[model samples]
Target chain A: MSGTAPEMGRRDGSFEREPARRVFASELRECRYQFKDGEDEKSPTFVLLPTGERSNRIFIVGTLTEKTRQGEQNIFYRGRVIDPTGTFFIMAGSYQPEAMQQLAKIETPAFVAVIGKPNLYQKPDGSYLASVRVEAITVVDKDTRDLWVLDTAAHTLDRVDALATSTSPDIVKAKEQYPSVDPAVYRKMAYDALAQIKM
Target chain B: MDYSEVTERISRKFSKSGKEIDRQKVEGKLRRLIDEFGVQPSEAERSVSNELAKEFNIPAAGSSGGTGAGAGGATEQKAIAQAQPGDWVTLEGKVVSLAAPASPAIAQSGIIADESGGIRFVVWAKSNALKMKEGAWYRIESAVVDEYKNIPNLKVHSGTTITEIEKTDPLIPEPSPIRDLRPGIGSVRAKVIQEWEVTHDRMLQSGLLGDETGTVKFVIWKEPGKEKLAVGTVYSVFYAQVDEYNERLSLNITTATIMQEEGDIVTATGGDVEIRGAIVHIAPGSGIIKRCPVPGCNRALSRQNYCPIHEIQPNFVYDLRIKGWLDDGEKTHNILLKRDVVEALTGINLDQAKEIAENNPLGMDEVFLQMRDKVLGRYVACKGREIENRLLVNTCERMHFESGEHAKLLNRAGGAP
Candidate 1:
């Protein structure tokens, strides 16, 4: 909307647009660093990338490998999206009604992009599990999916590159959170995803 | 919604501008804009509204957005293409890329894109409100915009609010071109011209690759003999890690790096080492150059012939340099011959160069031309390293290809260890 000089978007609205981060499905599930946003806030949880980066909002692209309606609300649209390396669990709620509708209309094995927040749950064994809170999901083309793969691969490599000397707080947290993650696996996932793309 | 439904929405928006336009006419305008002007339906709607407002002498609700640095209402959507530093902004974009911060104290950063373009934004670590999810459209508001390295950047601070909304049309960015290749995982098309033995301790295979843009040195670290880039073959290098060593960008063809041969590349797009070419072009400062007059700052005086630190005329000094191209029968390399190299090749020292400069009315121009004549047309094999795409010859000897010195020339390609 061209109106005046280039400036930050008008701050008139009460809502803010979140910046989405790209992460591989394999790395996302392994991430165990979950913390509250701003200490007192609840609802949206933060997951630290194994390489020490943190993000509440992440966008991922993959094939919608499976989907099902869970419980009474059918309200919970449970789905799994398979990337090059692993599959991500997506739970679409009433808040994501549009994404739910889109999910219902699209067939499985279709190229899909999902933008979601991280939701963490602790098991009885004390280990943590990370799944996605579907904020939005849409069927996309191969081109869009490949571009996503490229960006995600680049991001994953940045963390791997930084891991050698990263003693920063995020990296330290990541090391503590997912101590079992080889990081090599994530790098491989990124490369595999990129290889699938024609470019 | 169909075309008619979209047109009705356009008419309602226009009526708010206090302009009375027939609904049928507006629909006709939308149809023409879509069919003839090639405007998108949404864009045509906005165009029709603006046109009707202009016709009625009414102020357009959405005035043309200016591009200079300024502030605005946070709710206004600033397309990534229109975003600038200093704007209190709100907009929708897909998180396309993310970067690890140097310090966890600093906010995380990444590139956000829409159909307009992409931008880098930092979500303050302290904000902790949202670790933005990439690949989804968001409603970001109350964020401060700042310039990072001369480019406008968005900063999501404590007060910034992030709301994930329904996904919009996908925004797929163009892949990075060879010329735009920088340090990181870059995809490029290059030709392998030389390969070195694996390093003893690291087992890294180092070599050189060339593309039309320029030549780059590369190193690969993985299982030996799994991948071998043949000489003179062009290949698409993907996921290659680019790093800077000796202040030059080199690609690390590591375990993850992929290279598929396209064909035998005649371009000889390779590194600037072991160049065998003739001098076809000579730069202006090839002969009789001057150095800075300031003490302890002995930089060569630029074309302006002024010292950057002193901002004044530097004392003229005599130096001999042979600047020209070295064509390897396929590619031309910019080779610079320093004083010693010049003296060795042309049998002329700095004092002799000054004598020629003093006798000629054109001074350095006459000397530069004479130096070009002596070095031109002759092919020389030089062992050198490239600094910013220009070859700085450490050692050189004129080649005699037909004289059965093939082994000697090939040995030079190994470089002086």
Candidate 2:
């Protein structure tokens, strides 16, 4: 957790740590739009999730179903983390050597949790692929995955509620950007994700 | 009432006045000035008269300034306690304290005292007033008193004049024990127990200072000719401003005078507090994370993917931690579980996590996932020091839970409406 105490003196434009948002993989893949609020190159780019919320960093707990190690010198460790709703694609590279090394060594079909930034890449076929740039990852159990499922469901439902009732600038931007957003669809997704968890 | 007589009276005052006075337009202007603008009917008459004279090619009366009658009256001198809110008064008092301005717009703010009592005073940056040195007497004229939280505050505006005068009778601060210091100025003689690194440039020194009574955190702001304080040396800190943040007290020594005393003090340290609560929310950057490997720098690596000071590091050290919120049915407390505590709670050590990641093709994330599954939603008792809303947990244990309660909770969670 970030320090709750306010710093005595901090300069402007200093790096602010973004909280990792709890989101199900199914809702994460629906996010296709991304934008940066500030003109500074160092500013974080946010992926506007379909649920009326923008996510720069995300956290998810799921089962590691598949893995792939591609490239030689600048190696990339790619994996798929499956939750109750859908699968989240994650990639760690040379820049994050520790995460890459950890990704290369972990076993498949095991429960795992990941905290990373979301990136959207447009394919040549005019389709968008959403993936997570893995920052930290670790092995977890079924209980942890269940807890994550409940937490993510709550967060997704909150976004759905915001979409229906709130006219906040971010929600308004999301409404304007994604016109076909049906709050009912996400509400059901959250319920389904919750149902999959065993306690 | 008809304004024709008033209009004719105004017309007769100007030389070569015409018969072109529209009684309706004059009435409308008079009504708008009186009703819409809340101007006095008498003043509205003068304004309408001036406008009518100008329209008739006559020079406007009353020096062309309508509302100059109520400007620059003699300011009434009053004691600090006698001044009420919204009163304009000239106050002559000694500056008892100089507090750090909460905002850039406020150049200076602190307590000023006369014979009656002490009252808070603020000097606006736009006021262009002379700076009041702590303990020096100042005659503040035309200051507007405003109320904040039922206390009257003297607000120095552009019209307010601040003149530094000879020193008045000094208001001596009462010496108090370290633990007895509240949100005000107090004097204390304490020995430095621990010295922490200066994080910001404005901070000259910061550390734990303890007396025979109790220990409190002390911060000395960097000022001209201020020397660094040595650890274990007893100093008499006079007029140190006490500030409470996150329910903890700290001594702010901006305008305080520090003198090394000859006596030695046996310092008393605080004991650890124990809390039992359910871990409700787990914060980010928990589980297996990387930190700057530099010997002194242990900052957690964020989006920059490197330390701000050391820059891009080749080998970042792997660390294990669990930062989460604990709810005890009343309020939530931020609790930080270190590696040892996390390992004891989750049964997954840092070495085990690293090994599990090294062995699995899915990597270190598997460990984080496993740690999350075991740690989240578990009830535990933690013992630690409360620092800035966070419990630096040193020892922790899982509270025993009944299987029946778990099953009931699960059913309630599963049967969601």
Candidate 3:
């Protein structure tokens, strides 16, 4: 059954990680984590994963904390997880079958890494929501967290300088082609650029 | 946003550089550029960016958009013109007229005329009048261009290049003889034929004289230790100040100069006549007097009148009041008299008169009658300088009587003929 399980997972291939695409908490479109109640005796709480560059690429982070049942077949998990620089949303939908299964088995306070494309969700109140669709999952710790911040800062500055020097049309075109590019990335880039120059 | 927000944004943008840019300096430069070029804010911003980029090697942001190239071109031309300190310019013209010396530092303006133009050129007195031929061709060199009514004119200063060209033909048809004279200089001789004592402090004396041109009034000063000038005497006053006031030319004597009766200088043809009048109706309290009370008090005393301080009355007081006109004349002025002069004219001690007034109703009337004749129709020449429209004649030496030459000039000029 274990061999069949590995073969089935490989055949499905949805859980397979892409080697060329590097995932960091800073790069995640949305990140979230949930932990089980401290008094819970039987269930293991989910642990949070660090998201910035130097940290282990493992965490599912989001801003939403509540859980809701969708239809009768699927359960939705949502919460927020913050890296050193900022916070992002983590979400488990019906499409994230593995993440949903893991979420259901664990108690509250559980954490996991998430890999997915950034997506925008609109609420009925006319405000937009940001969350990451879960692709793969892992766990990380505090030492890894500190290095993520510094590495993220360096990478962000390079982007900022590039933006500042490029021709006006190029900037406009870059923004249009990469519609999902996080504006907060630019802000963080500017701040990091300023910090480096100050030093 | 509020001013603080805008300032914060600007500060953030400029703060990376180690040196701090004074916000006021930047604002002042902006305002000056606005005024100098008469440009709008956007245009001014672009110009400032360009100038800073070129001069300071600083990067300028957003310089592509502004008033188009033509308007900018014109503004640049004007700025270049203003920036240049010296430029060659020619003003070909005739010398039409000459103005009197403006001041010690400024050259007089000479009105010039030419086939193409007419303008005023400042000519510095370099070689006296020898270099400048009034009727001949005058070519000024290296004159600085200045603006008058938005039109360019030439100004000659100390460093100005100057040259005089020989004339093929005289440009000025009739040129008057040049004289080495100024407003405050030299001696003027005149004959004094009549005199009247105008006031106790000062006297007004006038006389006639005939030079190459004609005769005019020679108003002379009367001071202590100076010989009293007699009527029909010719006097040469050294270093007198000339002033044209109220359409009349008059001479003023300085304290350092001397006035003497020039007996040898005689008048040939008495020129025009001059007339002078005395001020009447002085304000009642506009003179000097001794206050009856102490310095700090407003009270007046009756018996043994004295200020409590030192148990003695101080001898000086100053107040302002108007006195009525005694002489009926075609024109009248408000006369000002000191209390001492009033007492002297009336021969009534003010303290005794105040006591008598308190005791008898007719005492004040008797004093008024005694002072009327002496105060009325008397010509009092005030010597003190004027304050606004009112003349404050402080010294008694300024009052003077009209001389016979003054009277004759007045009568001949159709006054009380």
Candidate ordering by lDDT (highest first): 2, 1, 3
**TM-score per candidate:** 0.31, 0.49, 0.22
Native-to-model Cα distance after best TM-score fit, residue A173 in candidate 2, in Å: 2.7
For TM-score, the strongest prediction is 2
lDDT of 3 by residue, B111-205 (tens): 45454334445554431222344545565432444443333344554323334555565432221111222232234555553343332223444
Model 2 lDDT, full chain set: 0.72
lDDT of 2 by residue, A79-147 (tens): 999988898999999887756776787889888777678999999998888999987677766656665
- By summed lDDT, the worst window of 10 consecutive residues in model 1 chain B runs over B65-74
Kindly report the root-mean-square deviation of model 2 from the true structure over all alpha carbons. 14.2
Model 3, A72-113: lDDT tens digits are 555676645554334566667777765555444444343333
Q: For candidate 2, lDDT tens digit of each residue in B123-160?
A: 87866778889879988876767665445678886556
Candidate 1 has an lDDT of 0.63
> Which ranges in model 2 have alpha carbons more than 4 Å from their true place?
A1-15, B1-250, B253-417
